[model samples]
Target: MIFKRKSSATTWQEVLEGCLRRDTKAQRQLYERYANFAKNTCLRYAQNEVEAEEMASDGFLKVFDKIEKYDSTQPFEGWLKRIMINTAIDHYRRNSHKISWSDLDEASQVPYSDSYYKDEHLVNITADEIMMFVQRLPASYRAVFSLSVVEGYNHNEIAEMLGISESASRSNLSKAKAKLQSWISAYVIQQDEITHKHE
Candidate 1:
């Protein structure tokens, strides 16, 4: 469905009030207004578009269910983002059995560092391409990477959220960064070669 640009504050308040009252049209409007934001938030944690769509849909259902709990004084977008992140965590928990997680002992062996990606490589890569590489990471690594790197959550917070130890979170993040560094470097080299061939 085509959605107009974001509504004015007054109009948004009206929509929120209608949603609180369980008005279907208002709910539809709200979904249209924030669907892309919600999906993009989920995509960082999802392996594919289908999984991201599922997480987004589930997050909206929770938002509607708990609309009364939202604080009017705070920004609604922040509130929505938290809900989406929690939903992604919930999704991870449910699928945890299918995803392999490194043990704390093994994780402790990996050193944590964030200086692997060079500025030159990053300057040549688009955000979408970076996200694509993130999506290719192992599920556990992806969760830790996105939470730590993209969402700015510390290892302690990530451990609590994912039911893993802080060491595990650090290890997962370290591995993720290493993998991304390798993939992105290769991608940059390939692109450079293609450009040179044309030259």
Candidate 2:
């Protein structure tokens, strides 16, 4: 017999109903459905996997506790993701920015310069592969870069949310871009060498 893949229907109404009835299976199903997104949110704010897992656990507990109050009209993942992101933000805020990271504030905010990456439709790699390079960035730079590039948050908004000056957000984003550029360049060179050898 071919088994159907299970994806729990996670409408807010369903989840809320489950939570109200104290159904363990519903809770488990809810966690299973959003665990990956929750983990990714934790990883964005955490320095390592250990912290990320802790954040994920803490976030899920919060979700269980608060599910009853959720607005059913809104997106369920959006609600779960907000809780996860808040959990990560809490962890990050506790550590505080390092005093030595003064360079974070050294640059002025420049409008994100559009490059060939923007004008040309050339991306030789998949989003998953690009994310590999992104994950290697310093935590501050990664957060700022992800916010600006992926989330499309401007410097002022990111700075407000991150508790940094606008200049600091911009500086971190610049450093992050430089790092990604260096990584992509190296990868391109390696690809060329492998191709030439194959010829």
Candidate 3:
């Protein structure tokens, strides 16, 4: 039998209890509530939307399978987010053969610079535009960037998670930032030229 209830009518506690009991309706409700968040979290690690969707699905499956292990002391959202991130990392590992990691030595060759665009240039760029540029990054660089910048993981933690040395994590993040700066600089210049042409 299909269980039907308005989302507002069901408290999170109730949903959690139902989920613990393995109720399909409660599971559906949970997915409806957090699917976007899961997908968005995966998108940073995934190369594209299709991969993100796959990651999100795989993440939810892991969440449901492991819900019994969740500690009550911690926030459920944080727990769920961790699962999603781990799922992305697993995806990365499975496809590691396909992803080309920059040599640790080569990473040092990429020059670091100050912010490429002025504050005014940044004001003209949308967050979506910036995310698009991030999505265009290499898989290795994108994972390091998302884990470090977006997820607030330190190099030590990132190194443990990705199974690389701390220096490699730092190198990947540096290369990621350098590449993003170059892309953003070019984009800002293109936008300025287009604006001038229209004037």
Best by lDDT: 1
What would the TM-scores of all predictions be?
A: 0.90, 0.77, 0.89
lDDT of 3 by residue, 1-199 (tens): 9998755788888888888999999999999999998998899988888999999999999988888898978888899999999999999888878877666788888975645544565788998898899899998899999999899999999988987788888888889988988898899899999999999
Q: How are the candidates ranked when ordered by lDDT, highest leading?
A: 1, 3, 2
Candidate 2 regions with alpha-carbon error over 4 angstroms: 1-12, 43-51, 97-113, 119-122
> Each prediction's Cα RMSD?
5.1, 5.0, 4.2
Worst 10 residues of 2 by lDDT: 99-108
What is candidate 1's local distance difference test score? 0.91
lDDT of each: 0.91, 0.74, 0.88
Which residue ranges in model 1 land beyond 4 Å of their true spot? Answer: 1-10, 104-113
Q: Weakest 10 consecutive residues, lDDT, candidate 1?
A: 109-118
lDDT of 2 by residue, 1-199 (tens): 9999898557756766887687888788778878888887777656566778899999999998887778888887888888887776666566665522325545343233448355422366666566677778777787787778876889999888778888788788877777777676688678878999999
Alpha carbon lDDT at 69, candidate 3: 93
| lDDT (C-alpha) at residue 10 in model 3 | 87
Candidate 1 steric clashes: 0
